[model samples]
Target: MDTNETTATTLQTKQHFEVLDGLRGVAALAVVTFHFMEWVYTDSSKNFIGHGFLAVDFFFCLSGFVIGYAYDDRISKMGILNFLVSRIIRLHPLVVAGSILGLLAFLFDPFGGHPELYSTGKIILTFFCSIFLIPLPVIADRGFNLFSFNAPAWSLFWEYIANIVYAFVLYRIGRSYLLLLTILSALAICYIGYRSGNLLGGWSGPTFWDGSVRISFSFLAGLLIYRSNWIIKNKLSFIGLSILLLLAFIMPSSKWNWLSEPLVVLFYFPILIALGAGATLTPVWKKICVFSGKISYPLYMTHYAVLWMFGNYYTSHKPGTTQLVLIVIAGLILLVGFAYLVMVIYDIPLRKYLSNKRNERLAKQKAGLI
Candidate 1:
């Protein structure tokens, strides 16, 4: 293979690692605990589990970095249309499947007849908005909220929007300018927090934007790390991962998890660095990391529903310790099962097809066959 061909091949290898998958498992489990623990145990009991939502932040960083690393070159070369098509193929199928499940969930009222829970109007709105991967406009008076149909779908909206922003705005800017834009984005988030009177825009500033700031910044960091070819090639991913874990442990006790914001941002830097450096590292850590990464998405998407199921059961039956332990164990089993289904039936096939298509198209373009 020529130099360019060899480079592409290497990148493909990075894309296929098990560590990223393992991280997915970890992220998903965190979300599960975040959602269900409160139901099984009181808030005081949930002290250990309450922070599961932060896993989404980790996910955002991972998504941004991984997507950027995977697609920056193609996006830079092929333009947004190609990028959108690829994204749609990669993300939309599962999204549609999830939406259908959400609709069924709403109709059945799996969350319960808290008539205040979901509205038909909000359900319809969330379905379409989520379908298009856009944030539905907030209709505060309507009782139905972004958490209406599929609460998790909201994040996907941010993910898609961030992808669009990257393609049109960040990716085109020179690397130095991209770094500047990232800093500005983080500051923008903080400013929005102050103005909205909530660090996460409590009820003001659009919900979609709630996580966009972090997503954009972390993603840009990933791209920069990749372009620089710095830590990954130097066997520093282990160091980076260590620092991130240490920071997460130490950073949360401050006022309001006040340190959480910056600490998370700090934590992701090393993760992106490590992932970008995937090519050169053969650390034993690679095995564990990749496993978590692969299941992360399914773990993420399915965990909420799993938690909800457990909560529903617990609320009605009020089981004891054995049952609760069984519930947790069952939830983990369910997550694994669901992740396998998603990976085998949904994620893997679709990803392979889209990638293969991209490769074939690139080959044809090289040969002027188009």
Candidate 2:
């Protein structure tokens, strides 16, 4: 009702960085392709898009930048509980859907060869845990990794952790202290990469610390980018930037150049986000950016379930290279379609419902109608 309230509301709903949104979509697609390549090659070293896993790093950076942009100042108005609830509403719908799909896949293909995982009890436990976006411990006999239902959900678990850190810790810290934390995280990422020869082991039991380092560094880098308001006012197109991102992700890792992944996460991605934030887009490009960003999270969250089912069939059939290419192309199309469907039918609607409920509750509270 007042000027301050009006200003806060405007900041909350400000227009996003279109190029960054499109880039997020680009990274998500690369991740899907990367998973397919993993299925085809079966050897991590031989996969063409071996660096695609870095897309998760990219997502972390983007998330940090966006969260800072959207919430760094507004946290005073919204409070930590409101911010956490907002994040849950934004992210948890697709998580539940992905877990349900994983459960169904496990049911229909109960004998997909992992005998320990076929038990109904484990499947139900996994489903329930996944609904809450909780990462389960890896039970080797049950084929359970960090997240049994959806493997990629491990990253989301870490993302939520980062969000918590942001609200309670990072957001309140002064810029100098935040920079110190970021530097320390970067050093840790470099150390981990140097030891492992690549930024690879973040998704499973043995390397959960690696995952923490990866998210912490990149997410802080993103926050720094936002806080510094770094930007490049060049005429860089989203298309060009998107292509560059694809190349970055698909680039092969070299044993001789073990520092590449860490360098990209520590330095390159933050620059990319800054440039993306600064760049301008045409009307058509803006539409593409909106569409791509809309589908990015859904695609990331849901595609793994489809891959789980397809991986079994592909392994048994052992298709030739040509057939594999076609299958991959078809799979990409199907993934896009399926992600769009989930976005339309579930994600958007559920978020709207939750958002409305929250608003109504807030209004009632204001009117002393608790």
Candidate 3:
């Protein structure tokens, strides 16, 4: 979810695993495609990319590895405050962008929705909670999602929780304690799977705590991979690893979802992360991987606004199978392009300005102290 380079003197990760970065983009694309497929296949078993939701788990695992690799040795010197500030700069710009886009889609969704049903005050309150990452699952129309305007922000909420825990607790702990915690989280994941029949319960109000469980194991496993040096040296290039990664998402759905989903989350995703970190990146694929990595977060954060529109369009029009295919294919391409535009026009420049401003303040404060 972060970048390949460390532009800041101390805040950025020293080096990135380019293959891992490229995998993030692949996961993000899978997620969007899955979202589109999900609407049509209300019974998820029929969805071709039934397991695409696991991409979020992959993301959590990758985030943990990236965070540990980036901050394990440096967080103490940077101090908790600076570390968190850096995280906010790295992550929150898109959070705000997503919220704003979600709100606009809500207010003006031409295909469907009843904006007049809610008063201005409630809408305003919901928007505030969303931008601040406060959960208010109050909108029935939006399936009582933790963040009504932006459904995917649910993961971001847990991501913030993980970041806070890292600053206050996870960073100081030894690998032994971290391993114990990871094991506990793995159990929680299994329990959730057995109880719920799948690993897909974290976005809405009823399944609120499921988000916590999902992030727990994957993120911890990721951190564990980094600390344990679990990188498996492999000849799999970016394209090879990508095809392998896509298999998990495209796997068939069946009665074993309860067991299968957790296994993938607990083991398969961690292995992918390890392989991705160690995989070779050919010179030919380096630029593609970089762009994929750079565009991933923006794509993830921004694509949902139009999802609502698509859902509305589908419900009202009930387009035929061929039309649906065309729409989804076109939607994916357009969304990717739109995400890139937003990344260039808004997210990157805003983050850069904030980073520069924060760096200057740090310099002035150091000068004053001297």
lDDT of each: 0.59, 0.84, 0.92
Which ranges in model 1 have alpha carbons more than 4 Å from their true place? Answer: 1-10, 13-21, 38-46, 109-111, 114-125, 137-147, 189-208, 232-254, 267-291, 350-370
User: Candidate 1 residues 1-370, lDDT tens each?
Assistant: 6333655676767646444455556557656655666676564223455455555566666676667677766665566787777777777766766665555554554544343555767657766875665555444421234544445766777777777877787667777887787677677655654454333321123554556665666666666665655444434454454444434423333344444455456455445446544634465877766656666665555444444445666877788888787878777877777777877897788878877787788788878999
Better of 1 and 3 by TM-score: 3
Question: TM-scores, in order shown?
Answer: 0.75, 0.94, 0.96
Local accuracy of candidate 3 as per-residue lDDT tens digits, 1-370: 1221233444443556889989999999999999998889998888999999999999999999999988898788778998899999999999999999999999999999988899999999999999999999998878898999989999999999999999999999999999999999999999999999999989988899999999999999999999999999999989899999999999889989999999999998999999999888877788899899999999999999899999999999999999999999999999999999999999989999998888778766767953
lDDT at residue 278 of model 2 (Cα atoms)? 88
* Lowest summed lDDT window (length 10), candidate 3: 1-10
Give Cα distance to truth, residue 107, candidate 3, Å: 1.1
Q: Mark the 10 consecutive residues where model 1 has the least summed lDDT.
A: 196-205
TM-score of 1: 0.75
Comparison by lDDT, 2 against 3, better one: 3
Regions of candidate 2 where Cα sits further than 4 Å from its true position: 2-13, 110-117, 139-143
Model 3 steric clash pairs: none
Error (Å) of candidate 3 at residue 271 is 0.5
Maximum-lDDT candidate:
3
Distance (Å) between predicted and true CA of 199, model 1? 5.2
Q: Is candidate 1 or candidate 2 better by TM-score?
A: 2
lDDT of 3: 0.92
Task: For candidate 3, report its TM-score.
Answer: 0.96
